[model samples]
Target: MVESLASPWRHDFPQLLENPQLHYLDSAATALKPSAVVEASRRVLSEDYGPIHRGLYPAAERATDAYEAARSTLHRFLGGREDDCLVFTRSATESLNLLAEGWLQSVLVPGDEVWVTTLEHHANYLPWKRVCERVGATLRVVPLNTDQTIDATQFDDLHPRVKLVAITAVSNVLGVALPVSEIAARAHAVGALVVVDAAQAIGHQRIDLATWGCDAVVASAHKMSGPTGIGVLLARRSVLECTEPLLVGGGMVDLATAEQPVWAALPSKLEAGSPNLVGAVAMAAAADYLSDAGIDRVESHVAALTHSASEALAQLRGVSVLALDAPERDHGIVSFNLDGVHPHDVGQIAGELGVAVRAGHHCCQPLMQALGVDATVRASFALYNDDTDVDALVSAVENVIDVFGVR
Candidate 1:
């Protein structure tokens, strides 16, 4: 057995300890929530629950304060200068759709091009695809290198006609960390807006929208140990100012007349109905928890775990680890296929052994096609996971091979 690396802050996540028999390695899909975030969300439902921006009662006032304060907390957490630039949505997928329907569909014309990498989740790919189809715009794909990373050399494909570049900061399947800053610069040079899908990177890396040089970035709260119903979309004030509201309702309009309707300001314009106030509070708590623990330390710990796990898994026979050539660069996600065993079978056997791993296309069917496979078993790490989790996963895979009678 390999020596296990203990997580220093594992105590913060009660779910990890409460379920002693389960080894969770599906953090790429969603992370287990911390106690602090759970408590914060509970407080909102039990004590300070009220509709925000609707009433003048004490509950409403307090709820409004908490809701707006949560926005400010995220603004600071993401190194955003303006709170109004951050729009809260139901999930990262919704945020991307908001950008697609509200911004891209409105601005894109026939013959315009939107460039995206093959490493995108469906959240990033499908929205652009639909928008391009609607507007008669062309969707261009950036190919990947042999190592499963975006080929930076092929960025010359980004021409002057490219209106936007939608890319993921980290691949959900391959775990390859793309050069966002470089891509942003290249996209900007061509006068194209850059939108980063940071769903997988937010919890594992430090995000500074101001310095990243991207026009917009989106992430799901659940992916970062927060609640499920809330997500963040951070954009420049200028960009938010230009985006048309995707959903229009009572809260989003300043004045609605029979003749002409005026929309509300930046964030409110995008947030239509009653917002997810409790989810916002819970996500703020999560942001605070992560910030207090130090993002750099969390990243370092997960990176070490990823490297060790990758090294261990590669040694096993009939195991094909994707991007094994550069395990150190992966953002805490390791995906592989067992020879002569279907990914579904491997996942099922691993699940029966008390290991929870995600298997299949992982919402990236195009990437699966590129990799010449229909699916893969993905073991993703988070701050709450330790070396024992990795050991459990590897042992479970060995059990799968043994049960299948694979050589």
Candidate 2:
């Protein structure tokens, strides 16, 4: 067991509705912002706002510096090498689209296969599917085992014809962490590039892009205690250079003429318009706050919450917790279903009792279908959650089941 580490900033959050007994467990859907992140955005949007990268005004230069510094912070956080380039997009969905529309089209040809997992979020799946649709390629789905982890037996099926292997670092619904480095290595053996969706991975675990050696990865800032409308696409410089730009706009161009247009270098080439400078600055502040709190400690705290919630949920009659197979799958999320009770009902009941939880298909309908359910009630944790919050959740769920007369 990891030692409990204190998060001084926990109390600084606005406490949502400010009920003394409020239990917030919907973090996987979207994280609650720390006061710093909220205030950072407020300060910029109100007091120091400016357009970045295209203006010569004092505020614009300041905004540009702050925004690019956010990029630098992200690079350092991911431990990206000098050869890595970071592309900012609207969300993880857009980031994946940017890659599929750009990088995959440039490299993939007829008969090439891009391997994806059945456990992917639609953001990761559909873009690759579109690429295959456009490029006359195939999208091969890697199967998951009965235990819900990626079936390693399928490794033999990968071959040189496989141009890319896209997988999620953690299943948003299942909360299971895939063997990303190992999977990336296997894909490379067949000369395939790997793209990891780390939208759920960053705050829970450390990500070293250089060591992972995957061709690319995507993450959303909103899911990691930052502002929404900003996501990152991390790519090796060589891989990025070969990717065609999907959106051609002002910031991404070096020289433009009627006859032909030249795109800017990597990183800038991918960011087409006036970027979300305020959001990026706020995201960096959030990242800095988390770093000060220490990721290992934050992870340990979340693990304790997950293990407790999983165990508590499993003890309930007719309730099944997802992602209990791998001990390493211990992240902040706890997804499960109550027998004879609708997931939406569970969410409603929890909400009525001052407990916030998520219900419905959590953007992974295939995974939900595979689990033999229409949807689930997900209780995701963050550093702010404590034993009191956990107890409230368990009690609220029990009450919900009782009210529904579910065994």
Candidate 3:
């Protein structure tokens, strides 16, 4: 049976709604925003713009309410409790850095172990490596199995020396969703902390942070269909208490003294200077938008689209889909390499064909080295994508093979 997979929410994105021919397959890079989120952002910039927390004026109060409301929505979105602290940042990269500096650096001893994976995005990997370098901690990188899952043998003995486990919810290149809950269980069993980079898995999967048992979680707004220049760091109170301020400025101070300075509360101390207030409100609107749509439905929608695309692409001669044997392992992304063509050429040809797919390392050069390929073409799906988008991708890949005469 041919799957008549059409996204019911396709019309939600103004960009896709306007241009039917433009098949956007690069959503894993950054998802398209829904009108609801766009409108909320517009209202923030034009109508409700003001300083938050410090302003006693009407506009300031409204700004403060909207900003805090964004936090409240995200708290619930991440299945956060009252004790959890949510701090806004410029991007997930910054969030990871903040944890590395504020929390990880503060707690890590010279002999501690910070476990990472070869599958991590650079944002997750580099921070830990640099932090380990600074603190004299050992950075242990766990290799991946053939199917892009973590190798079990690497965890033969979960030691207490492992101070932190930094990993991603989904591999950006392979699109594989790891067993975070299980990983966290192992980490916690050894009395270690787990910090997850959920930048790719944010909207595609419903993240119950408590259930996952992560000490801290980081994500970006633009990746989840919100405005850019804003991201978030959600951490447990214990982690926040241990974490010092990454950046301290105007909005984050409790009391400024000529002799000595006093720090603000948990989140404020962490969030210094002027935040992206407009982006925060817009991101909350995005959280609300995804909440209303239901994440389970979105996950299923993307999974189906991904499986179908993976099958179609794998059928092409001289093409190999990464982790094709374990399609279920990945979510919302399908990556592959043509036997004879460069990924750049494939990506360029695909782009010329009106299908937008990412053709590079996907910011996972370490992962590419693990896969033994310099780069792979990545077709990432979103909630608003459907079978037609997959069709365009398949056709574009076929074009690449034909252009290169690799058949």
Candidate 4:
């Protein structure tokens, strides 16, 4: 069993302690925030709460500085260059919608197609579908192989009409880690922009926007052990310059006259209204905590747990684990369905046994339809998870399956 390195922040997260009965295996859906993140939110809400970029009071100045500092920290965390733009939104879904409506809608013309994988979450798929419908663009999917991995050869087979490729770095349901860098390079060769949904990969993997060379990427703060109601959008400045604003209000505009109007630069153009100031500060603190803990170590720990989970779960009769049977490495998500049993029932059983796992389509109905299953039980891991958690999950699953029996 691989152990996590000594991390000071590890001591600060009280939720890490096992409940002797409860095991949290749903970090992919949402993670428990550390004390630092929690205190950061409280401090923002109580100590220095005000409208940023519009006030001159001391409290407002502090709020403005903290908010912008969060931006800078995220920029650094994402390895964004000076020419990159980071837009704050409510969630990863909102960020993707902003891109589909703002950037892709304005740039992609009629008959142009957007290439996406079948493994995408609904958040990535629906927005693009809407944009394609509105702009008279086509929606083409890159089908997955029987192993539940993307067919890399399909990229070359893409139609010349393809103008943008929106993909997930790691699938929330399939747990497959997609070949995003290769896809980005190939798509760019055909003059197509790439928008990656890194919501499941951000806190678990090292994402270098420069190396990934995508046009834009989105992630939610809550999945990264931060606060909710705040998501991040990272894009190339040139690409960001070509997009329109989704929301028009407060600080996003530079000058507004009845006859003529001008919007602010890159980021401000995309970020409208008061913004999630407290969420941003807390997210930045969470990012800092992850950075200090060493993302590589954190990733390794979670990967180990997931790998162990696959092995242990497979030992149980009438159980099947996706991606593990394949030769490819999967992300932290482990999705499965027991024979002759509903996923919701399995989830309920596990929950009663003190294992918190996600049930249902996991917000990926399209993918779920493709898989020929209505729902799946998914157990995802995080840095705080250890082998004991994996053992607990395996034990809980065995108990659950025994009650239902194999079909």
lDDT of each: 0.89, 0.83, 0.88, 0.84
Off by over 4 Å in 3: 151-156
Candidate 4: tens digits of C-alpha lDDT, residues 123-214: 99999999899889899988878888885566986656788999998988867788778888888888888989989998788877888888
Candidate 1 segments whose C-alpha is farther than 4 A from its true place:
none
Tell me the number of clashing residue pairs for each predicted model: 0, 0, 0, 0
Model 2: colliding residue pairs: none
Please list the residue runs of candidate 4 whose C-alpha ends up more than 4 Å from where it truly belongs after superposition: 1-10, 17-20
Q: Model 1 RMSD to the real structure?
A: 1.3
Can you give the TM-score per candidate against the true fold?
Answer: 0.97, 0.95, 0.97, 0.95
Model 2: C-alpha RMSD to truth?
A: 2.2
Error of 2 at 92 (Å): 1.1
Model 2: lDDT of residue 145 = 84
lDDT of 1 at 311: 80
Per-residue lDDT of 238 in model 1: 83
Better of 2 and 4 by lDDT: 4
Which one wins on lDDT?
1
Better of 1 and 2 by TM-score: 1
TM-score of 3: 0.97
Q: Is candidate 1 or candidate 2 better by lDDT?
A: 1
